[model samples]
Target: MKRKIFAGLAIRELREARGLTQLDLARRIGVSPSYMSQIEANQRSLSGTVIIELARVLRVDVSAFSSDDGVRLAATLREVLGDPTFGGLDMTQQELKNAALHAPKMARALVDLHRIYRRVEERYRSLDDALRASDGTVGSHQSAFEEVRDYFHFIGNYVDPLDRAAESLADRIGARSEDSLSRLSHHLETIHGISVSRHSTADGGGFVSTLDRARRTLLLNDSLPQATLAFAVARHLATLTLSDEIDAVVQAASFRGSDASAVCAATLANYFAGSLLMPYQQFAEEARRMQHDIERLATQFGVSIEQVCHRLSTLQRPGNEGIPIYFLRVDRAGNITKRHSATRLQFARYGGACPIWNIHEAFETPDRFLVQVAEMPDGDQYLSVAHAITKGGGRFDAARLRYAIGFGCELAYANEFVYSDVIDTRKSSAAVKIGVSCRLCDRSDCRQRATPPFDRRVTVDPDQRNIVPYQLG
Candidate 1:
């Protein structure tokens, strides 16, 4: 069955951004003005053929019509409405979908307002502690981070100008050569007059890399791996050479305050660094050849495994896109430290992830890749791969940070990933049932549930001795 796409709001906005009228766009896409108006007014669904034509006419990626954002927004709305504060409201799935697809700005505003309310409520609950410990700057700082995160999400995690600039810089500096690190160091010293130096761990003060602008020197920790040292150098080069491009993106973003702007600039520099280290076209081609093998790709690109996973997620280069994979990093405490998705799988925004996920189990088997065929409540199945990574601890006394890096594409793309070759994606019964989070899950019979469904009524019966004590209504 073909999914109906009612992306009226997006279409209208894109048309207006291009300064095209209904008639003009209709003529360009070989459709009548009335038909175009109907399509933009949510009265009609666009065919796949027309969608391609529209993409070409609008000069945007065909993925512009993908329902991934709407799915994510709907999941967010579900989580928000599942809050006990809104438990009395009888919001239907269709209603939430409508809001997500038709009025995303309003939906996002509601989510933002709820976030503010949550923060205020938390502060109120601990008034004395908050008053004594916080200078009222924490909320703004956290809000700034959230704003920057959403900014990246809105851009589909692809910074085109910065990416292009980094790719060009990579080619000019011979980033793919066997002496890539040396080439980068030479470029930095000769072109930018910045000498690179490596310092012993004892003298580094736990810093990975430190730049002294006055001395034009970059001091890196000698304890760091070769790939990490190269990455740090590439990141510094991005900050220097791609400053103008980064500034343009930040300026155009119109973030709320200077804090968010600064964070955005730093994040864009990181994106540029990743692009430079793994130039898009070459990396994508090699990734395909390597069957999206994380270890092999990391080795081929001279980068870390986590870096390879992250770069794979950002392969949203329009027509040249790789598999639409979602990437996340979770700590031992189940807190998602990093997340980005180009697929339909949306991570929880407020609470811990589903306990059944293999990401959590990865911690038990260190350094081994754990694969799971999991299905969401919406029946979307994924071939997820999780590997536990330990960083730091260069010395025995240094703190070792443990995190699990998980990335996956939809089961439909399972053939492209080497890890999925042993699994049977065709068996629906084999897929473990998982949800975004415990609070929003509707799986009433789940014995592993930590909490009852937020929006459902529970009936507790003493006489009943089921796996769960309470029956969900």
Candidate 2:
């Protein structure tokens, strides 16, 4: 077998990112300047020894050079093109890949343009209140938020360098126990010279967290769960310690607007926080041992169920990868408030989620986990579990937020999930048929379909008696 070489362009990117000239890097790797130039230009492949040496000199993970940036860009562009608004555009996957590989800058520009178009369409064309919320006067902020979500989705929700840093931070804080809040608090107070304060919504007026730089005090919402409170502290610590690393990733992303850039910056900080709370290797092992049970994982880590689910989706660190899961959160109205997928499954980007999805039923059965074996029109099956998570409203008059969280992986990995115990994995036909959304679904016989598929035709017969008012063809 021919030994696979890492991306020469990626090596060059890392070299330049480290401010090392060709001769400087060549000297560090014990190679000739000409050889280094040839390797960067893809004229000559770097040997295994040199790749290891390059990583040592660059002070970066080997995966930095291993990944094909073009492939990543192509995947993101393909998802961008998959937007329903661009439904009629005739483009092949190969063409999209070529465009991304050969003209990456143009590909990025196209993505930015498409995002702008989507915001415009949502604002001007739709009359719904949700549309107003997503594309109101604060359109740019919403677009930036959506862009950040897509960024995580395309990258498989894992950031190796930040994850490693968080792991190291956890070790430094001596947070070996499942209850890490006290250790984390000690580290923040002693090592970082920051004081932690507590307040409630009734007292703080709904502020979750506030950092006073001058006073070196961190005010946290007392009403928050212990896990959430610890998360706030961890996130603040990450912001203080990992600013440069997080900023570096955000800068490398080349976000088109400052809003997007800021959102990404905050997201990377959160990544660090999540990694710190659930150190990758240990968390991945526990997840596998527990058969990927989110609730059990929550108890083991002393975190919230939602936090456990979110962290599960981010376990895609190359050699230590865990189960790839897709997570979705929706409001009572079926609007997708949060979505990220490590699987091939893509959520709807334009409108509400499909009503047939079990996530909607979660609201009716609050605090109860509902499991389903759902299959898409493309024949891809998933074992999804959902439950309604209520927040706040502790008092009689206080406001509450109710949202359903759903997550799952493909049926091929069904045996690994605890929710799959009740599912008959032997019968593929038993999966509940679902779709991305009403506008994209094409099941003519679906009794729950709310609208005709965008690409299909529908016939209405006044005299016809059926479950629906019209027949889809």
Instruction: Tell me the alpha-carbon RMSD of every candidate.
Output: 2.1, 6.3
Summarize candidate 2's per-residue lDDT along 190-230 as a digit string, tens digits. Answer: 98899988877654255668999899999888776778878
* TM-score of each prediction: 0.94, 0.79
In candidate 2, position 428 carries an lDDT of: 71
Q: Give the clashing pairs for model 2.
A: none
Ten-residue region with minimum lDDT total, candidate 1? 132-141
Considering every candidate listed, which one attains the maximal lDDT?
Answer: 1
Residue 388 of model 1, lDDT score:
95
The TM-score of candidate 2 is 0.79
Whole-model Cα lDDT per candidate? 0.85, 0.80
| True-structure lDDT of candidate 2 | 0.80
Candidate 1, overall lDDT? Answer: 0.85
- What would the TM-score be for candidate 1 when compared with the true structure? 0.94
